[model samples]
Target: MVSRRVRDIEYAIRDIAVIADQVKKKGKKVYHLNIGDPLKYDFKTPKFISEALASASHSGKNFYADSLGVYELREEISKFLKHKDNLDITSDNIVVTMGVTEAIYFLLAAMIEKGEELLIPGPTYPLYINNTKFYDGVPIEYELNEQDDWEPNLDDLRNKITDKTQAILICSPNNPTGVLFNEKKVKKIIDLAGEYNLPVLSDEIYDQITYERNYVSPASLSKDVPVIGMNGFSKAHLMTGWRLGYIYYHDPENKLLDLKEGIAKLARARLSASSIAQYAAIEIFKTKSNHTVEMVRKLRERRDYSYKRLRQIEGINCVNASGAFYLFPKLDLSGLKKWKNDKEFAIDLLKKTGVCSVYGSGFGKYGEDHIRLTFLPELSILEEVYNHIEDFVR
Candidate 1:
């Protein structure tokens, strides 16, 4: 029998793809805009990074790596953080994971006791909520004001904190919404965590994929708060399938020794991330590459075009995304009375128009009446997707 915990976990982002496949078998074309995979679009990984992986495999570097990570790769990551965010992280403080997904799992597994609460943003990436439930922990959601460009509501966040709260999670260049939390908001969250003596888990996988100026990492701004910053090459380097990511713990006062040790224990149990990928990731920090710059430029064009198109639609409205590649547009269902909710509308749209998008309610309650779409497709494809959506809505 499956455990109740396993049965209770829900991943809405990929769940709709099952229905999409059934549609495809019936001779319909499906434009996959549901997932945040850059490779599905025009993005490509850098050749140097791929060549490094090939060379490492050819040269017998396939042995099991250190549980924490390949030391050289960890060192390179430390240096990259220093250069990019002015963070003084060390190799010893980093743990390599299969991806940011694993990093989140390890962090939650190590920190969350049964019934403890994790304060997360509503309409968040589903992983945080799912992982919390997997450990029998409670997920407390704070609001993200759509009227304020998806900025987190600090007052709502403060009200949600209780003695049972274990930690706080922040996803800058956030998934589903593509909203980047500014420096002021980041600092306020850190302050709240510090006051409550809770650690902060920062997901920065899309840090380099921003359309605007570079974002400030919360760890860099933190003085005494314990921060666990998670990042990987999946989004920025166009290496989602490679499954290489790392988490760095920063505690200036050494207060989080127990939490750090817990993460290390979990890392050892997993053995290590991909050895070949680690060696290749080392090459990523060593070489100067323009792949990310070019990728962001293309994404910016798509984002602008799609945002403009969505706004023109009579019943659709969305805030312009400043970072990442998603736009969560609110749908006015009054005009089209056939659908009951966003999910129903999304599935019907898929059947009728062949555009696959995840409904907003799947993210959280605040996500109701909205649908999340990736602007990752090229301009021409996006034009077609929008035309179909506009027609479907009308």
Candidate 2:
């Protein structure tokens, strides 16, 4: 009887080891800008994906391989999304899970129904609010405006739909505000989920981790809306522990074939997701290299040097993140009057400046006074994590 929803998703990163044990009891040098594992951030993985996983582990092609995966990696994910997003995809609307975090927990346990409702927006990506409360559903949210850059209000997603909502999650170049939605505001949230017929779940695992805008896929702005579209090879092929991931589906006449057969019976009960990492995701999707275009030009030069040292630190503000490798900011804490909110100003700035980052109120409820920061580290450790967060916020 130990599933109090997997013990509240195992205390969701419990303030990352209580801020890495208060920055190792104050010896400092912490700097881990709170999680998004690009192989712990110096990003390595392509040597043709470790030589096609050492030639499919000596060419035996290991055991389990067809739980909707490895049909030539879903025919190389339908020729890598019809040569990268010219989409009208195939390979039976793909599935191949075990990464876009189990293709977003088997597309929210195959299109969320138990007590339904999903919505999503406010500082999203806490695993889509812990897989919509571990599949019992009901996670709603809808705020985004950090002064119109974190964009997505569509009348607060059409007044948080009803008739038990069911779906509408998004995550553009967005996971803690890397804000990229504008393709005419993603065709007006795919015509407001095709006028509330609902079904969107679009994570796009940081679509090639963008920078100066252009990573669209809300199923290429609506084949009349029903888009599951998750993606992976974890952040454009750094292959986050090569768990591999995929989940496309434009709308097989929309009932979603019993939600793609409950994600192919939970991808044949998790029986596949590593067939030598799908034969090393077919040599990292046919050698599309330049290592994610030099890791998105060094994450747009660490999002322009941490958005110019978080706008010269006076009551921080940020939002210039035109792609992933997060930023979020927004920290006045009004003269730090012995803080009480943004998770006690990020656990008192990780007990005064070891700088571990993460409390955008754990990515929901309109990120109470913000803090997500992950400039993926190194530009001299993000210029000493911006001079220890501007000398612990002055």
**Best prediction by lDDT:** 1
TM-score of every prediction relative to native = 0.99, 0.35
How many clashing pairs per prediction, in order? Answer: 0, 0
Give the lDDT of residue 153 in candidate 1: 97
The digit string of per-residue lDDT tens for model 2 on 1-394 reads 7887877773324556576776787687666788877678787877778888888989988878888888877887898788878887788889787888888877778778778888888877787778888978888899889888889888888888888988888888888888888888778877887787787878888888887767877786777667888888877778787678888888845657777887788788877777887887877666646888898898788889889988998878887888888888887777656676777777677767777788888887788788888888779888987888788778
lDDT of 1 by residue, 25-55 (tens): 9899899999999998888888898899999
RMSD of each: 0.9, 17.9
- Candidate 1: Cα lDDT at 79: 90
Span of 10 residues, lowest total lDDT, candidate 2: 10-19
On a 0 to 1 TM-score scale, where does candidate 1 land against the true structure? Answer: 0.99
True-vs-predicted CA distance for residue 197, candidate 2, Å = 3.9
